[model samples]
Target: MIKRYSKSMKKRDILVIAPQPFFIERGTPIAIDLLVRNLDNFGYSIDILAMPIGVSPNYDRIKIHRSLNYLNAKELKPGFTLKKIILEVGMVIKFITLMSKCNYRVVHAVEESIFWALLFRPVYKYLLVYDMDSSLVEQMVNRFRWLKSIENRLESIESYVCLKSDAVIAVCNSLADKAAKAGSKNIHLLTDVANLREQANIECKEDLNEISQNNKIALYVGNLEAYQGVTLLYEAARLLQQDKVEICIIIIGGSESDVQYYQNKVNGDGLKNLKFLGSRPVGMLEHYLMQADILLSPRIEGSNTPMKVFNYMASARPIIATDLNTHSQILNNERALLVPPSSVAFVNGIKKIIENEDYAQRLGSAAKEYVFREHGIDQFRRRLQIAYDTLK
Candidate 1:
């Protein structure tokens, strides 16, 4: 029989394990914070076991434990062979210890770390919830081609995790379908929506004047990875240079190599309108989004419905994104200008928005209204509650 815990149980505890600690100033950490905060309102207690990702100090919330030691030399490799063995052994030891010491009713694993939680579910008797946000197998193959064999092996491991887990939570329908195909029995689609009301209410708005007076400011947020199509934006900016349509393209985040590669392309090609802002804090991000006339998300084909898309909706900005299945699922054609993944198409989309103010406002208003109603945190909380309640 499946063991269950009551909501009124005096010692009910939920354990969350992720690669980063909760309350950190990053995407996954912020998502965990939202989950914990929402669950707390329902009188559920939480315990967290987190590994540090960036250089920030560990957060101190309810029953949170942070790992002190970094991974050894062998654990830092790209492939899953040696790293998987080490992670499995380490997680099993840590989970066994935690199980012996506490009375956790649920074990929630985020991202690729669900494999570790599945290893201990048999002995611990906890409800294992596998949170699948991104396609690990696709990411491995796309990013690291040399490790194709290792990536294929890791795909089986992910499938095993899904098959063994009691529940699976995905950030989108595409990811949910992938997990279900991999043998996950109970699957829930949980889109990554921003706390729009909170972001809209941010008091700081001084950066509005910083926008270049000569150009129509277009903003792009999120990591500057190759698949994000940052280079395409630069190319589009270059194409619009002599059109007398002054356009300023602002990029938010990317690695050093990514930054350098794009910077060289912009400078070498004399694309003077493009500017790279690197990464910014969340507060500043809201300001940037609010000050912009348009938001651009030229993502290539991938299993990603980026979190930044919600923020774009929250900002009530006319968005020009690529016509991909994942993006089309979240955003309607009426809400955004869904263009083919090409520089010429991107440039035309921007031109359409700039030349027609009423059309842009209509699209932006529809996007904001739709996202606020359908993809807010309240919706996320309801979905999560349903998933948790099913454990009984």
Candidate 2:
């Protein structure tokens, strides 16, 4: 464990709490990594307490306490089931025990872990900071109808945390508005940031000259969840079947089940143009992004403004996204090709891009410029610093 004593009497100690271990490729892990890396620049020292759910080997410098020996179960059958209740209680106990041994100026809990911090707020002698990345309430309500009771309880827990915490950081304006409605006085909108320097360092070694000459590749780099609209991409491919436009949709990063599900869908529907490359390492993601003619963000109505969108912007690739509030906030109609969340619209958008290469290039250039000016790591670090400094 790397230990450091407080040099100045006023230097605040910050503890970042999350369910997933740091350095993972997921959005939350990426956010944690950025926060940790910018700690010194923000004039604070951070100790992390992350669940061992998806522990990564890259986090050697940060002190981590593993908790909750729980299995990854997909189905949600009931609320307050005996086994789940026991697990939740046990995890909370372990978290509190570990927290008791450490002294910190602020307790920064991310996502659902804010519920645990709220439960132990009275005993914890520090300012609580709730860093809500997504609307858990909205997600729970959408995912499981039977968990309405549990969802209400979780919402109450979140509301309690927001009410009690010294400060709150939401990743988007919509979430920030929700936090404000929840009575959080010190809510700040901290948009997702791209580690552009690292992404730019990825060498584009793939010889895309031949591929680029024949076909226009539209890439979708994210999980294969239903809300992500992967099926719509397949339908869009079907729509443009005989247009004489050679277009390929490359999907990267999804689980085994996701791969099988999408594969079956595409094959069953006889869509040969959509290719599933499965999951790739973070280093390879940039290469794929670089090779693409356009990036697609076809998310359905949900609380997701994926961190990958920022990476897409950083790649400086022409983007075609659904005309949703989340996408509109980042890639306004001027910077990206805005289409409705439908197969026909997506197909038309791609056709538009293929027809006007100059417009596509202009949009790509403008999108990259916007991202660097607003959503770069330096901007993220500054916003975080301001939020931390505002904390009592």
Candidate 2 residue lDDT tens string, 183-257: 989987898876656745555565443544456788999877777888888788888765656888878878877
Each model's lDDT comes to: 0.74, 0.74
Predicted candidate 1, C-alpha RMSD: 4.0
Q: List the residue pairs that clash in candidate 1.
A: 252-278
Name the top TM-score candidate.
2
True-structure RMSD, every candidate: 4.0, 4.3
Worst 10 residues of 1 by lDDT: 72-81
**215 Cα displacement, candidate 2 (Å):** 1.6
Clashes of 2: 0
